[model samples]
Target: MELSKIIPVSKPVCRSSYPDNPHSLCRRFDPPLLVCFSCKGQHLENRRYYYYCATCDLEFHRGCHLFPPEIKHPFHLLHPLTLIFLDPDFQSSRIPIDWPDSSSESDDYDSYEENPGSYEGHIVKCNYCRKYLQPEEFGMAYYHCSTCNFSLHRICAYIRPPLAIENLKCHDHTLTLFPRRVPLPCDACGFSLDTPFFDHVYSCLLCNYMVHRTCIYLPRVIKITRHPHCLSYTSSIVPSCELACGVCRKTVDVNYGSYSCTKGCRYALHSKCATNKKVWDGKDLEGVPEEEEEILEPFLWIDEETIQHFSHDHHHLKLRQDGGSHENKFCEACTLPMTVSDRFYSCIKCEFVLHETCASLPRRKHHPVHKHPLTLFHPSSSNPHKVERKYYRDGFFTCDGCTRNCCGFIYRCSEQDCEFQLDVRCASLPDPSIHDCHPPDHPLFFNFTSGSVMTHHLHFFIQPHHFQLLLHHLHLLPHHLHLL
Candidate 1:
């Protein structure tokens, strides 16, 4: 008999117990035809072999049976990892491990006090991918070490990255995988020495170039919405004066890695802040040619004082330095009541109106809070029925930045599936902003570390000029306002 025929005739004992049957024997199927009970799909379009149960009509991939009872993963070798199935239902009877009853209040308090770091009580995530293990119907099987409470997905267990990496972009010498977490500063990004590990750390003993796994692949050159020119990743920035981040308006430590302007400008951003998913577009523009800048005009000039605005194109708006005085009339862009001392644009034929600042807003611009370029969008101007169902469900959308619901013109992200929207007020504030209320020389900058507006010598809100200005400052400024 052929070996293929003989192998199919053999039956294997399945570790998984079937309902009412303590011992379930599985038979090999030469050509898999049914969906796998664990994975919920065929292995390879009926090409691979699998184990099937005739009584329950359930199927399992051949690899599922081949899983060893325990494994000694190279990354975590202090203790052996055991194979276990994590149930998704949250009420499964097959608990991975049983804990002694912590009903005694003193025992719980004593255990927590001894090791507070281990009792974070966060949801279990895969040690490899750092993703929450949301198991599917039949429960997701993975390798677990109960002693350390470390777990890895089934796929990550079998597929391991090389132990040693050479010719890495961030480092010069051959970097060996450090296997476990170490309290050492990463040379690429200034983290993990004082702070917790961002991911796995790779180390070069020869050059002392220790770096995080994720930081090894940091883009050499990239463009962010915060700056005008492209920025290149730099190991350090030696400035005569203290350097503040252009994005968060926080101080940039010169000793650490950061992204600096390529045009020799006095602008720099923290490595972590520059690569924030909401800040960078995630494209590596190392050798790519820069495209010609697109025109960002909000309207075409019909005349010097009159123009056809993009949002309210149905009528020509006439610019007015002073809008006289109106009680009921409101600026259509900001949804604020028109004031006598406001510079605004009024529609030539209709009640449509806009603030001068609002009308001059470009068709597309980048807000500091979002990664993608935001387009000037009018909820009422789009498809009336479509907008009604999508945005006007409650007659207003909650602004992602400020969390205030407003019925006004919004700067919405252009990317599909991204619903990030910013109200006119929050979108207009410039980073490292200078306000006319203070002085021209003193620019107000926000300090992310101290969580305060660093005015240096100027006093902000010492005496309020108006209630509206005070309200705006109170709403945006953080709790601890440092005068310095």
Candidate 2:
């Protein structure tokens, strides 16, 4: 047994059983009607013994009473784990510890710190289970390593396997546990094994296959919403030039493991990127058959030049290709002024109009910035946000990708509770594409920036006279707006 993984707070508090409560004092009860204060379970029994507090009228499972106050876990050898309490919403309890600023000395461990709260209003997840820990309702206790900012579920700390294993699904040969920590890359995920919380390493003697314990059971076949074809895990890809990961737009090292399209296609993705929680839905499609998807048209045709758009079903729109001057007219979808030579659709009854390209945009699209499908939301005229009359007459929505205020039809994330939205311009940007104004050899990429400034690279390509106009249009200052 690994003694470092389990360290008790103090010697187990031995107390006498309450003779007044016969059922509570017993080791087992049918159906377990009594509630345990620690686990909050209707059943009052577990592998650990039960203890009762006659003074407080509280009963607890023995495991809760003996929970270790500190322990050295193999996953995080840098620091010892401390027992911490969190509410249902994952908010740290009123209890205080050395945090954000750890150098300050405190007279008492349980006393509130003089400094403001260190960690609160932050989402904490168990590193092993990847699930939110809620100790408030269930009376569960979790382990935390503040120095390393690592967390582990209380039960996960007890999950210890034998030194060796055999009969694996992903590999054919028997695998042995490597005892010592090695600074090498895992052959399964192509990520360095020296990473934190990945100390458990397994290896095969028949071949040079070595992998971190966490990556030993990678799915053989998986499907993601971003790709059309199913992807299969491969030990390595054939050496290639200029190969980039489909999701991150970064170069893929061909010598390590990765996921590649089973169908004859050039598409590939890094194992780490493909299995990201934001990208993969955590479904293994090894034996599952692919389902056919039905294509839906964005609009219905009324005549040769007229159609009814889903967004504006109140009236039919007539297409116009002739160069006509509609001085103040703007496309409702893109919020850009209608050019004299542009082909667009105009409402037969009202002033609603859309650029030809914007009118044909799909109702749902896959964008490189987001993993989930985004649904198109028509502009709300009642909204107060708006651009200048030159760009749009009224109404605007903030683009989540570029953080720009835009007056146009926006695509919002389809996932519930996710408020991510972006304008048509930011949504249509290609990941790796060439710009006519910039050098052709250096392809431009869509980089999301949090700072309110554009990068210096723009000054080299943009004309002097138009630079001010570009800043003015984006509502950015001289030092603001970083774009790629």
Provide the RMSD of all predictions against the true structure, rounded to 1 decimal: 12.8, 12.3
True-structure RMSD for candidate 2 = 12.3
Best by TM-score, which number?
Answer: 1
**Deviating ranges (above 4 Å) for candidate 2:** 1-167, 197-199, 224-226, 239-242, 248-250, 379-396, 436-438, 447-484
Q: Which ten residues in a row have the lowest lDDT in candidate 1?
A: 108-117
lDDT, candidates in the order shown: 0.63, 0.60
Residue-level lDDT of model 1, residues 174-258, one tens digit each, is 8888776666667776776435433666788887778777788889899987777889999888767788778665688887788
- Model 1: pairs clashing at backbone N, Cα or C within 3 Å: none
TM-score of each model, in listed order: 0.64, 0.60
Best by lDDT: 1
Give candidate 1's TM-score. Answer: 0.64
Count the clashes in each prediction. 0, 8
The alpha-carbon deviation from the true structure for residue 484 of candidate 2, after best TM-score superposition, in angstroms, is 18
